[model samples]
Target: MRTRFPIAICFVFGIFTLLQYFSKHPTLTAMYAEILDWMQIVFVFTLLVGVISIFKIHSAKISRQERDWPYSILTILGIVVMAVLGFGYGTEYGSPFLWIFQNIQVPMQSTMFALIAFFVASAAYRGFRFRNKEAAVLLITAIIVMLGRVPLGHQISDLIPQTAQWIIDNPSTAAKRGILIGIGLGSITTALRVILGIERSYLGGRS
Candidate 1:
């Protein structure tokens, strides 16, 4: 029942939302605000459910001595450390947990993203060898766009900004419009399915 409740709520609110959007009455406007506030309260409760699910999964994995047990140990230790730092020990900014988050986690996340530039470079190298005209055009355009935003490129060429603007205004806008329409249609279909009770997968499988 708990699992299915969110889906049921989504359908109920989704229909009300669609109506509220088209509504002209002042009473309906107030109703929308009241409903939205209630939705926030429900969402917070759902977030707690999600956190419990996370804890349960990780706890089971640790208990089973899973393949990556050391990582799970580290995860549990990290969560406990952070919670202690934030709630028990109090944040000193110089505390071990805070320091690790800023120095280790932040830098690790940055370095991981920085690693993506290598993959992009490798892709570009292979893409540049393409013999097909359309692929060649794409590769050239990618290179041009990549260079356009840099200070070095500004010194090297003046035509880049114009080309970038043209691509963004023409192709990008059309692509975005197509994507938005598809998203809207997909959302409506999902909402209707939930409302009709045809999509009960969210309620979890048979016990």
Candidate 2:
């Protein structure tokens, strides 16, 4: 009964949502709008539950003197500070929340991205090392692509940029399309499994 009830509800709602794509009736549209509002209300409750769960887990860790307990203190402090700034000052321009976000969050995000770029460069350098014919081709293509997009490559030869642009427009675009098609097919199969109750993992082994 536990699994059956949820599966039935999912099927009903899934059908309703699926029909909504072609539905133009005012009543159906109103129902869809009501469903969206309900979703927002549910989302707020879920967010609260998640916040409480995080607090409980971290508090227990700190109380037990667990490894890296100091990090838990920072995590809780960050959450409290952000919540206070958001609720008290509002998130408008010139507000404390915005100021903190701009000063702290933005710089942290930029630093993370800069670190990622360095990691990517290191990985690419390792991958480009001439171990095989395929690696050599990849390395050459990467070099051309990198240079072609830069002023140095243009200074070297006009053909380099043109060749790079052609490679991107043809081979890269074809590969991207093929990948997108595969993703779409996979998504369709997964959706069908869930809708048919074949994918029961989402039910958390209740069945």
- TM-scores, one per candidate: 0.68, 0.90
Residues 1-207 of candidate 2: C-alpha lDDT, one tens digit per residue: 988898887787787887887989999999999999999999999999999999999999999989999999999999999999899989999998899899999999999988988899899989999999999998898888989999999999999999899889998899999999999999988877777777888889632
In candidate 2, where is summed lDDT lowest over 10 consecutive residues? 198-207
Residue pairs with backbone overlap in model 1: none
Residue-wise C-alpha lDDT for candidate 1, range 1-207, written one tens digit per residue: 775777667677877888889987999999999987987998999998986786788888999988887787777777777877788655676777678789888998999999999998898788787689988888777777777767666788788866776777888799999999999999988877777677767666432
Instruction: Output the number of the TM-score-best candidate.
Output: 2
lDDT of each: 0.80, 0.91
Clashes of each: 0, 0
Off by over 4 Å in 1: 1-11, 23-34, 89-104, 126-131, 151-157, 196-207
In candidate 1, what residue range of length 10 has the lowest lDDT sum? 198-207
